[model samples]
Target: MKRRKVPLRMCISCKEMKPKKELLRIVKNSEGKINIDLNGKLPGRGAYICHNPQCLEKAIKHKLFERIFQQKVDKEIYVRLTDILTENDEDI
Candidate 1:
């Protein structure tokens, strides 16, 4: 069997390259709305972050999303992301 290549993405907070599925994706759609792309199939500009809360905080503190999206990220988006993370953490 041929060896398969794994898709990799860099975490904006940690600056670490990791398998795409291991990170969470955030996307900005055509309407300029930002959302967490849980399925990773949303059509839009995407940025990745690690599953850890520390990475999420670093990204927020440094305004990584604003830089990546080229616009201000609404507070609701951050709230939503944090909610999602906490929910996932509880399940683990």
Candidate 2:
């Protein structure tokens, strides 16, 4: 038997280190499209956020995506992220 290593990621909003699987990923693809990477396998530059709404709101309020992606983020992207986060919360 072998011990498995857990991948850790930092939440951009909360600045907390958590297991990768527990964080939501957002990616900026090669074509410069920003999207929520629900599968966490999207090919692009990625930023991590916690599953909590407070973290999401903090990220949006601070415009962390703009700093992460180095460009302006569309309002729809935030809306979509919020929708997805809330939807996932309901399942918990």
Candidate 3:
């Protein structure tokens, strides 16, 4: 019998494996655009987090996104990301 390997992703906030798609993807493209990878098809360095404001807030507060992307996240970008997450929460 052979064992199947499960695909796992580390959540930037809780730092646990929940699954790939279960976590929202944050991608930094070659051109240096940081955005949520809703389609999960972008080619770049990626980070994962749960689709919750609290998780996102925790990641932002601890600067985990910067660590994951290896780039300096500007204050304005942080503000926009928070706003985007807030809107997503409302839609959910």
Estimate every model's Cα lDDT from 0 to 1. 0.91, 0.94, 0.82
Best by TM-score: 2
Worst 10 residues of 2 by lDDT: 83-92
Model 3 lDDT, residue 12, Cα: 87
> Residue 63 lDDT in model 1?
100
Clashing pairs in 3: none
Q: What TM-score against the true fold does each predicted structure earn?
A: 0.91, 0.92, 0.74
The residue-by-residue lDDT of candidate 3 on 1-92, one tens digit each, is: 99988788988898888878678888898998887777889888888887678888898888899987788877776676677678778987
Could you arrange the candidates by lDDT from highest to lowest? 2, 1, 3
* Candidate 3: 10-residue stretch with minimal lDDT: 76-85
The candidates, ranked best first by TM-score, are: 2, 1, 3
What range of 10 consecutive residues in model 1 has the weakest lDDT sum?
83-92
Per residue, candidate 2 scores C-alpha lDDT tens digits across 1-92 of 99999999999998999999999999999999998899999999999999988899999999999999999999999999899889878989
TM-score of 3: 0.74
lDDT of 3 at 8: 87
lDDT of 1 at 67: 98
Of candidates 2 and 1, the better by TM-score: 2
